[model samples]
Target: MSYTPVYFSLREFVDPAIFAARGNNCWQLLSPEILRAADWLRGIFGPITVNNSYNGGRYSESGLRRWESTVGAKYSQHKFGRALDLKFRAPVTPQQVYAHILANQADARAHGITTVEDINSTPTWLHIDCRNWADQDVPVMVKVVQP
Candidate 1:
């Protein structure tokens, strides 16, 4: 049941350096859960931007980040390809999306979204990750954390 994104391209999910080094093989670095979740978000939230560098935009660290990258925490889920920072278009905001996910826990869980960074911590973007919470004995509700 591996899921590939229909609304996104491989270049949109990785940094320019990674895309240049691994090409399409970079897809191997991204988790299927994260990929599926991204597509699901797009279907529900309309247009969303991950890494727009592929299209000459400035965003490149919104998705999978390199281990050596200093953009986030040393152990950030973005480095493990289990997370994404999405910037939504007009008619929708990150806070709104975050509220929707929190309000629809079951739906978010079904889409493999185990965590969402707190809206206050990430006011401009919605950061969702598929980090494994089973080993942590966390409850079924999507865990909201401060990045």
Candidate 2:
């Protein structure tokens, strides 16, 4: 009953180091909730690019980041495989995706997305995470984080 992303591969969800080290086994390290959320967002939007290094693209740390990586915060969700920085294809912008999630909070929550980085902070990509926001008593369905 485990849900795997229909629109993404293991490479897209992991960095080059993890993908090379764990190979297909990398799926075991990822959070199912975050994977489900990714699939849901991909279904609603068009194509989403996470880590494209497998295809000779520049993105690598957009998905899962290793502990040694200094990309974002030291305790970033990326290190725990609970977050993703999605770069949408043309005709689909980050602002549109953010707006969609904000408007459809219940639906987004149903798909396991609890937080999203502010659009202003990430103008090129949409950062979504399955953080445990219920413990914080945040009234919002989807919490918009500044970072």
Q: Can you write out model 1's per-residue Cα lDDT over 50-110, one digit (the tens) per residue?
A: 9998899989999999889999899999999999999999889999999999999889888
Candidate 1 lands at a TM-score of 0.95
Give the winner by TM-score: 1
Question: What are the clashing pairs of model 2?
Answer: none
Question: What lDDT would each prediction earn against the true structure?
Answer: 0.92, 0.90
- For residue 108, give model 1's deviation from the true position in Å: 0.4
C-alpha lDDT of residue 69 in model 1 = 96
**Candidate 2 on 12-71: residue-level lDDT in tens?**
989899888989999988989899998998898878999998899999998889889999
- Model 1: per-residue Cα lDDT at residue 77: 98
**Candidate 1 residue pairs in clash (backbone atoms < 3 Å):** none
Q: Please give the TM-score that candidate 2 achieves against the real structure.
A: 0.94
Worst 10 residues of 1 by lDDT: 132-141
Per-candidate clashes come to 0, 0
